[model samples]
Target: MSTTSLGASAPSRAGADGTGAATGPLRARRRWSGARLAPYLFVLPALALFAAFRLYPIGWSFVLSLYHTDGMAQTWAGLDNYQRLVDDPLFWKALGNTALILVVQVPVMLALALGLSVALNSALLRWKPVFRLGFFLPVVTGLVTYGLLMGALLNQDSGAVNWLLQLVGLPEVHWLGEPFWARISIVLALTWHYTGYNAVIYLARLQGIPAEHYEAAAVDGAGPWRRFWHVTLPGLRPALVLTVVLSTIGTLQLFDEPFIMTGGGPDNATTTIGVYLYQTGFRYFDFGYASAIGYALVLIIAVFGIVQVKFAKEED
Candidate 1:
């Protein structure tokens, strides 16, 4: 009886050991798999949120563009919305005004930014911090707040700008009233807001440039103008390209200032594509046409961006 019992216990112990040996690798593999998948599991929620909020809306807007939405019912419109865009005078006017800004405001603002960056970076400049802060202060202001402030200042009656002009024996110009002067006010306001932001961008790029390049240029008997042309300009090419694309995009999408300051007013002189899109969708409940406008704006931005990048590369 004792011998049989000993023999039975030894087999049970052997079976238990064999089972642990086989399961150990499987358990280890499961642990390693969990470790490998941990990062993806952690990031899954963020990816989901992005798809739900950002990607889904963009995709839906494109789908919505193909239908006529009149705030009550969505009717199948095919490409009629796009066809309407071709014949729309207000759309053309908005496009023309946008083109004017791209041609005028963007170049002028970028030039001012470049100059401000150079001046601020120079050793001869005193009170660098003060100047830098002053120049960059506008960029920190909220869009709505700045727009209201500018609206107040550019008011035809009882405005500080007109008051100053009156003091100087100049006529109180109708800034936001007349079409020509209204456009001028927009250009000025845009320049005032974005120049410093671009300057800061340029300043950061300027800091990234090596001092050795400047020194080498100087040692090679390159004057300030020559050095600037050969070294500084070349060094700044990347920043210039960046600013061009960004400023173009920003100028194209100008809604707030024009909306708040001019109300796209004085015969739609200041109406940009962005403002037009807003007026179409929200004000008139023409969602389909507005979506088409949005897509058109996107296409225009893409074309200009590609062209600008290619031109910048060709310069290299």
Candidate 2:
């Protein structure tokens, strides 16, 4: 009787909902099972599509890379295509040019974006809606249209930019004919296209920062510069990191600007990985080699993304 009494008084094991399991473990198990399965069930379709489209194609491409195919049974030529890429000077040059753009264009564009975002966020900026629309307009403009308009604008004879330079008594810049000038043109286009988008990103983030921090800084006698450096910058770090990583990837994969505007060069100065991939696969019919380049680019982007995330985490 004492044992029975003690057992009855013993603390009960609780189920997930904090109810006594002895009341209904079976029901609890059913509930837990459903909970466990729910997420997988919800994600099943996306997983299926990823497997079918992304995973399968990647696997097939790896297999294809090991062979020489004429759209039929491929003769195995292990590593030959990869070896060919090593000796391909044009490929290296294209990569170098891309690196150059990534180094130069990304920083300039992001800096402009950051400044523009700060300005737009300022209460001092009148006609906020109009200014926002103006900045964002270029971002949504069709790539083809931008390319055509820019091409026309950079035309040596009647281009608006050259005409303006001439009007200012400055030399008419040979915008497209020279390789350096062509590279600069692509950079200009990239900056024009993306700065607004980055600014918009930054603007959204800026709006989320608690106004109290700025108020506190002001209370502490922090000047506008000090408050901005302390409050605004820290708040904007995440957005800036995002902008950098995305811009890096975009610059690395850049194709349309160079392809449409410069046709990859006055002398291949504007060619990038994307254009290289196009030339390898479509123009040269070397899909396997192109796939290899694509995979390499994926790895590069992954590494950079990892580094950026790590740095951001550290900063946080």
Candidate 3:
């Protein structure tokens, strides 16, 4: 009887221990569920704001594009506004100007940025932080302020730029007054303002590159230029792709510089799509047509963005 009672007590104790172990984990899991939900709850407000402000505005713009409006009256116009866009010569001119800037300025800016970044990353360079800050300062400056400064500097007669040209025995060319020079000035201003921003991005990416890769290249007797071509260039592919796409989008949306400096012409030479869109919607009071132009710009950006992403993936 003693032996049987002892065996029975042992089984009872084991059963109690097993039940407690399982219950403890089950309670812990319940607590974890609440913890996991807390992150989602924290993000809910931000998601709601994005949906209301960004997503809703985009959807409403599309809807508004399908209707003719004069601010006081609205009527369903279907595809008429898009058709008008097709026939508008000014629209094409603006698009061409935007395309020209994108083609010419983006590559030049990115190239300069890459070169500056590489130079800054070199061990030979000193005062790196100061140089980086000085280069990036223009990006933080107000766009209108930059535009005003550019306009004053590039003025045809009494401008500092003309004074320098005359000092160097070069003829003083019309900077903002002539069509060709106006376009060139816009490109120069854009490059000055944004190159440092791209350079900073490249610098950040360059820092993440492993030291071992460069050491390995050196072991194989690769010189600076060779290593840069083979390793640094390949490593910077992702940054290059990002900067190119961003530059493309920015150039297409060119406005403030042209509007504030050239006022869209000596002969509409610098009139970008953004300036034209503003003139159409606000100046001409053609809200429906303006919405159509906005959508067209969106399409252009989407197409270019997709192409850039695909090109980058293929290179990878």
- What lDDT tens digits, residue by residue, belong to model 3 across residues 126-195? 9999999999999999999999999999999888999999999999989999999999999999999999
lDDT of each: 0.93, 0.88, 0.94
Q: Write the per-residue lDDT of candidate 2 for residues 130-225, one digit (tens) a residue.
A: 999999999999988998888889888999999999999999998888999999999998898889999999999999999999999999999999
Instruction: Give the C-alpha miss distance for residue 153 in model 3, angstroms.
Output: 0.9
In model 2, how large is the Cα lDDT of residue 285? 78
Better candidate number, 1 or 3, judged by TM-score: 1
Q: Candidate 2: TM-score? A: 0.83
Clashing pairs in 1: none
Native-to-model Cα distance after best TM-score fit, residue 248 in candidate 3, in Å: 1.2
Top-lDDT structure, candidate number: 3
Task: Give the candidate order by descending lDDT.
Answer: 3, 1, 2
The model with the greater TM-score, 1 or 2, is 1
The collision pairs in model 3 are: none
lDDT of 3 at 165: 95
